[model samples]
Target: MTDDKTLGVYDEKAGDYARLMDHDTIAPTALNKFLSALPERGTVLDLGCGPGSWARYMVKAGFRVDAIDASAGMVEKASAIEGLNVWQADFSDIQDVAKYDGIWANFSLLHARRAEMPAHLARLKTALRSDGRLHLGLKEGTGEARDSLGRFYTYYTVAEIRDLLARIGLSVSDLRTGADKGLDGTVAAWFTLTAHG
Candidate 1:
């Protein structure tokens, strides 16, 4: 589910968040894995596609892209990108059935409360065709917290992530854990997983 308080943070700081284009993307190897898993010319849905950076990246990489975010400001910024199908809606409520060949939830789903995660993940499975790919990025930790900027976040351990994916009928293909600077200048632990249903 979408958290109104967290959405408010993104809405109010959309420009600052857009500046996240500075660090911008996952590793090249991860990119190659994601592409190799998809069908040639397949469509991709970018959940919580803040600022359109990855939407632009995926389009350039040859996938058709549909990006959505709950923040109106995020939608405004992302919609400026030429040819991007940017929508203003919460990803948890996404109702498409078998519509995408890949779902890119890069650091996006973390905003949802843990209690709300399973249902939304089930939705992701419903959104994808059989064997469709999922590239997920999540903060690595055991619980939830709010950032200095007031954005709510739910973190997970690698085991928790694996279990969550498995319960949703996804088969884990690869998992990578690392650290990166957060928007607040703190070192953040993160995990990236590649899975297929």
Candidate 2:
């Protein structure tokens, strides 16, 4: 289930959030790496795609992109991207099996409760086709907390994430770690892991 308060935060500040993501240098590099691991014109899901900037990039790159976000505000923005299929849906709603060649889950699954994460990852793993790529970006820390903007997050240590993915049969192939200022105006440690099943 989606957190209502987090949805409210995104709905009210969608534009600001979009602008912040637009300038993220690290994500694009990670995106490029993720893309390189996929076949040409592969199917890709921008899961929890805030504002759909990365989805827009993938669409422009000739991938069949389906972007999903829980916030209606975000769906409105992502829908504006030509050649992109986007919708509003929570993480818990995903149930596809072997449907995508690549899933860009960057920083999106972090919104799930820690207790809910293992199940979520299992669903995502089930959603991927054989040898499909899954890119995950998550904050590096412990426990759950709401940021200043009232957006909820669940943090994980690098080892914890690696183990979680391994248990679900997704092997981490590459990783990048860094800190960046988020829309909430704080720098936090985060990591992106490129995994494949």
RMSD of each: 1.5, 0.8
Question: All models: lDDT?
Answer: 0.85, 0.91
- lDDT tens readout by residue for model 2, 39-156: 9999999999989999999998999999999999999988899999999998888899999999999999999999999998888888999989999999999989999999999999
Model 1, span 1-197: residue lDDT tens: 36788888888888988887646555456767887789987999988888887788788888899999999988999999887899888866789899999998889989898998888888998999887888888999978999887788999988887898898878887888899877767889898988786
Worst 10 residues of 1 by lDDT: 20-29
The best candidate by TM-score is: 2
**Number of the top lDDT candidate:** 2
Q: Model 2 clash pairs?
A: none
